[model samples]
Target: MSIKKLQIPTYLSALSVMIFIIVLTFFLIVGKSLLIPLFLGGFFAILFTPFSNWMESKKVPKILSSVISLLCMALIVGGLLSFIVGNVASFTSDFDDVTSKINTYAQRIDEWTQSTFKMDYEIRNKANPDYLKRVLKENSSNISDFAMKTVGSLSGLVLIPVFMFFFLLYRHHLTQMMIMIYRDRDPNLVKMRITSLRKVILHYIVGVGKVMIILAILNISAYSALGIKHAIFFGVLGALLNIIPYVGPFFGVLLPVIYSFLTKDSLFYPVAVIVCYQIIQMIEGNFLTPKIVGGNVNLNAFITFLGLLIGGTIWGVAGMILVIPAMAILREIFDLSNTTKPFAYLMGEEKEKTQKNEKPEADNESSE
Candidate 1:
């Protein structure tokens, strides 16, 4: 007599997976303050690995190389922030003018409506020119509260570079530890998969960088042609926000439209801005990203959108930013195991073979 293999019920397997996910989510939410920076650091480490290695090859100590890498990153980020802050300072300085213009516009629209349609354009008593100003004034406390919270989170911000530094310094040790942890599996397969994941992530990042540069050029040209105020500011910012996916592009469009409305003499400018941006958006989404970024990611649109929502819900903006890379990693990791291949398929953009490409079942039966 021979023993047969034991089978786990499908329901039991699914339930176990669900329980694991629930537990993992709970932990992520609980430890997010620490985890967020650590995750960000790990990503930066991955992105900087090649640069770090180049420094090491020149006989620089690992610690010093890591520090140098972090400094480079800081300078890049510092410059971008400086650009935005300097422009934003000037933009915000004219808030009184923005409010005044909006109020005047509201009053004019109200007059037109009352004369033409015989009703007040009754959104927050638009008849009152000061209503818009009052609304902003009333929300000042809430704005200050948000600013305070952002300032409070600088502690976590401070930890990001620290984590990146250590990650780079001990990158080899970390690889070894991972391989040792998977002692039962062939270490070669583990190493191969890890390398593949890094390449994919790196290529995706480089592609994204290219997309940003192209978008920045296009946005600045369009805004400049339209004579939009702070053309460089909006263009650079819009390009930057595209990194966030779904909601990002919307806000990217919204910002210019708001400014155009506030500062321009006519409604035509805002509509023109929207039209120009949409054409550019179509080109970026349909062509640029698909050709450049999508290949490395290999995630279908549905899964990507779902990931963005779940990430946003879990960790707010940071979660949204990190989730795509996390999904890319998980999808690739799933591909490593036969048991997890279905999940990989679910998360990926790969297609199945057509009926015409497959051998018929009747042919197999005849051969058997």
Candidate 2:
């Protein structure tokens, strides 16, 4: 008996995989420079869309409105930068003292371990000191490199705002172009998808913005009450870091903890810092987010954490901050197609009883 031969497209499959890997690597290398600005521009454009629409309603020219919006953003950022610059000396001094205090704490820990555990201090210190020093050196180098690269890139492109201005100026045309490109057969479906995406992105921007503001205020108030040095600096830092989700809160708390440890002999200060962060996080999770973001875009905690992790791994802090909004947008797109609707359901906000109870009008119409 002759066995039937199996025909496999091995070469094609291998070639496909290789091509994908190469493409991915190419994007990863260039994405830092290109994608960051593109994404930031896109997000800002979305955030400003409502204002643009409002301007149009008032009979403002799109170009003028776009310019005004960009100007407003620049002024806001410039004011924040001025605030930071004004307090830079205090922030730097506090940070340096905090670093010294952390080193002292480590030394104390080493002594305690030697006394209690009867460990060899010299051997342990020798084994770990070089490793810690090397790690710190590398981290410092990476930070410096990143700063230089960012500044270099920004200097090279003095025309980004010009690009953004045109992008926003022709924003309506861009949406129309997208619809024209994709809506050959089903205009209604394409329109629905666009509508959903706009809603998701808008809600996310507004919600996250409000949350950050609240966290900033809470941090500032708590640090002021504790009499921590550079309270404004730490508050602003916390607000910026809060954009990074789960890991952000830990880093936000770290600055104050280190400052408290350095400036105060009492351990209560550190404890108070931790308690304040926990309380603020609780308030954010329980009260502020629900009210501001509403229940329209509920995400599962585990998935949210996973998105943060994956995004951070790929694009560092920026990716982590963007992941939820990206996920929301993706979910909306997936929900537009019948084949991918299940995936959307998995990612989307849980439906209320009233929404669930509503019969499908399309189904009823079709039956008639």
Best by TM-score: 1
Off by over 4 Å in 2: 1-29, 85-89, 94-152, 155-160, 185-189, 349-368
Clashing pairs in 2: none
Give the per-residue lDDT digits (tens) of candidate 1, residues 1-368: 99999999999999999999999999988888888889888888888999999989999989889999999988987788778666765654445676567666777878788899999856535345456445544553353343323323676778888999999998889878889999999999888877899888888888888999999999999999999888998999899889888888888889789778877878999999999999999999899998888668888889999999998888887787788889999998998889899999999875444444455766787899
RMSD of model 1, in Å? 4.3
TM-score of each: 0.87, 0.76
lDDT of each: 0.82, 0.72
Which residue pairs in candidate 1 collide? Answer: none
Worst 10-residue lDDT window, candidate 2: 143-152
Off by over 4 Å in 1: 1-6, 122-124, 127-152, 351-368
TM-score, cand. 2 vs. native:
0.76
TM-score of 1: 0.87
